[model samples]
Target: MDLEKPSARRQEPEGCLVVAIRLPVRIVALLVVVPVRMAWDALVVAGRFLNDTVLRPLGRALLWLGRAVFVWPFVGLWRYVLVPLGTGLAWLGNVLLVVPAVWLYRYVLTPSGHACAWLGRGVLAGLAWLYARVLTPIGHALMWVLKGLGAVFAAIGLGVFGALAWLGRYLVVVPAVWVYQWVLAPVGRAVSAVVTGIGVALYWTVRVLFVLPAVGLYRWVLAPVGRVLAVLGREIRDALGHAWRVAGRISLAVGRFLAGLFRWIFVEPVRWVYRTVLTPVGHAVRDAVLRPVADAARSVGRATRQALTAARDSVRQARADVRRMLFGEPRQREAVARREPTGRETRTLGSSTTALTKD
Candidate 1:
């Protein structure tokens, strides 16, 4: 049997069909997902850029501010407070350990057989006693040797004193007296005579050679000197007088010129300044400062004078009052004298009364 000719149409496999559907789905999903993934990635990149540009800078600024505010205080607290406290704790722990060790050493090991303090005291006492006992014989021997040396020295000293006394009389005193009388006294007399003779000779020689001749020479020389000096003095005086006349003329001319210049330049303006500015300013300053001071001084002087006068018057018045009070008024002065006793009269009467009473 002949088969019919197969047509050119191809049949789709089931797997291929399924694969095609899945591929479409996957392509669509990928197409959508790619853009979403890209957008997500862009968002992540932008977020990172923003964070790097803005958030990082802000964070750094905040961190710097935090450090500025807190770092020094924290460091100070750590260094000054915490560190010291820790060191103190460590030192206290060490001290606690050492204290007990020292205590144990002092209590137990210092004197292992007895109480340490009493044993130490007793040992010290015994050492002192032994030292004393050892030194005693040495001290006695030293004393005995010193005593012998002293006795020897004393004997030597006594012998020396006796020898010196004898030598003073024999060697020094009599020799000194004999030398004074023989050598010094004769030498003094000879020297005095030689000196007197030389003085007289010199006086006569100077009078003859120097004084008389010098007077003649001076007189002879001074005549010519006086003549020359007089001429020179006259010449100098004439020259000085001419120079003074010239200087005076020149100075007057200069003064006239300067005065003319000053008058041309300054005198009128200066007069105005003196009248307006300088005079007023000087007067104001003087009146404000010096005048007040002068016034105050004058017032003080016047007040002082017045006070002195018042004091004098008060003293005088007081003296007069006292005199009046003591003596009463002038009218009663004679009465007062009469009432008071005279010393001579009272003495005479008392003498008579005493005589009569005695009789």
Candidate 2:
């Protein structure tokens, strides 16, 4: 059978009904969508303003408050209270449990283990000696006696087995083979033939009554109807999509016009007032008032710092005088002699200095 190529499949021509339906549908969709698109754009702008002015700051404050209330206490407990407690517990366990365990293992258990191990080795050696010297000859004699008895029993068993086999062949095997060949084989063949004939007839009856009609209905009626419905749905979807995009462009142009009008009326005037009026006023106020106040504050801070330094020195001098009056002067440490000569008494290059002559 030859298969059709993809390009060989032709598109159905659009009828007048579809063309008529499309124009009205698209017009209705565009009118319905324009208002919805503008509303959506307004909602977007409002949401952004609300987020920037109110919700974002509120969320930050809530986050900080939550950290203070919920997170900081747990962090402080882990860092300050629980961490120290755990450290102290670990130290106490090392002192009370680990130290004793180590000592007991080192001094007590080690010697006891060694003694037990030595004892076990001696016991094992004795058991090994007993097995090697006492048990070997007795085991060999017993095995020889068992081998003689096994040979005598084997001869008797073989004769009995042979006689039973001869009887079974004549009584059981020959009769079973005869029945299978003459009686069962013919009956089985007849039953199989009847079943095969019934199955063939049933297959053909079901095909004629049910399967053929279903296939014919799908090929002749249902497929064509499905194709028509699919084309109509595709056209409707395309029209709606095209209308929505055109509405969005129209919404964008309207938004730009409104924004320019608002900027000209409100924002530009506010900017002009700030630039021409408020800026010079603010600069004049800063130079006339704030500069004098800052200079006086700096001078006051310098005088205060000098007074504090003077007071600190006076207090230190009084403390020293009180100490001298009460306990007298402190004793000075005595100087010790050194192997190297002092700087004032050092030898010059003209002076002869040897190890023997130095003393």
Candidate 3:
């Protein structure tokens, strides 16, 4: 059988057909509404593109120029001008504050020497006034006490001196007087008696000798002996004089010989040895010993420097090796690739990335 036509089978009343026609009217309204919405969306996109492409760059340029002219100038001025000005003002403030205080302190605090002189004069005047008003009575009182003490001391001193005087009289003076009278007086009288007897005998003997007429005989005997003795004394003096001259000559020769020996042995030999041997020997020893020591010190210093250099190099190499072992070789290839520009290659890569992102 043939399928019935959908339009022929539909049994729509006039009012329902009118309603279906109104549904088409609503669809037509949507067409105008969708177009208006699309137009509004397009205006928003255009406005954003205009702002980003034209206004944003202009604003950035204006901001950069404003910073260069205004902000940067002010920063330079602050660093170079305003800062120093402010510092000078601060220094001036400090000087103004401190100078007055210093002046005030100098004015208020008096110098020690001047103040001390004034104080000393005032104290002396006050002391003199006090002494004039009160010291006489005080002095009298002191004198009275001193007088009483002096009287007591004098009484004690007199008692001591009296005892000493009594002891002298009894022990010293009386014993000395008794010894002089009893012992020394008898000895003196015996000496006087012996002396008087010797004088009497000597006088008798002199008288007897003088009466015998022996003076001429004594003169005759002694005259020949005196002549003989005078001759002997002259001979003895001549012999001593000759012996003294010979001894003086011998002493002069010995002294000359000893002086020549001393000059030869001590002075000339020592001079020759010092000039020829000791001075050269001392110089040679200094050069031989000190030169070798100085060279050895220099060699040691050079060796130490070389050893330190070798150790430093070894440490640096070891550090490099350790770094390589731990972190491996750095990716210098990536850095080199970044440094080496290939324009077509970069463009191809950018296009491929953009295509992938779009897909």
Best by TM-score: 2
lDDT of 1 by residue, 1-359 (tens): 21122358894454443433443444444444444554555577679989999999999999999998999889999999999999999899889998899899898897784676777999999989987999887899999999999999999999999999998999899999999999999999999999999999999999998999988887899877886666556444544444444444555566578779999789988888899999999989998999999999999999999999999999999999999999987764344456534665454534553556643
Question: Positional deviation of 106 in candidate 3, in angstroms?
Answer: 9.1
Q: What is the TM-score of each candidate against the true structure?
A: 0.28, 0.71, 0.22
Among all windows of ten consecutive residues in candidate 1, which has the lowest summed lDDT? 17-26
lDDT of 2 by residue, 1-359 (tens): 11111356676798886676677777776788788888998899999999999999999999999999999999999999999999999999999999999999999999999999999999999999988898988899899999999999999999999999999999999999999999999999999999999999999999999999999999999998887777677766876777677777888899899999999999999999999999888888889888888989999999999999999999999999999999999899899888767675567676645676664
Mind giving the per-residue lDDT tens digits that candidate 3 earns over 162-223?
A: 99999999999999999989999999999999999999999889877884557665677777
Write out the backbone clash pairs for model 1.
Answer: none
TM-score rank order: 2, 1, 3
lDDT score, candidate 3: 0.75
Decreasing lDDT order of the candidates: 2, 1, 3
* Model 2 ranges off by over 4 Å: 1-21, 273-359
TM-score for candidate 2: 0.71
Please list the C-alpha lDDT of all candidates, in the order they appear: 0.76, 0.87, 0.75
Winner on lDDT between 1 and 3 is 1
Please identify which of the two predictions, 1 or 2, would achieve the higher lDDT against the true structure: 2
Residue 268 displacement in candidate 1 (angstroms)? 23
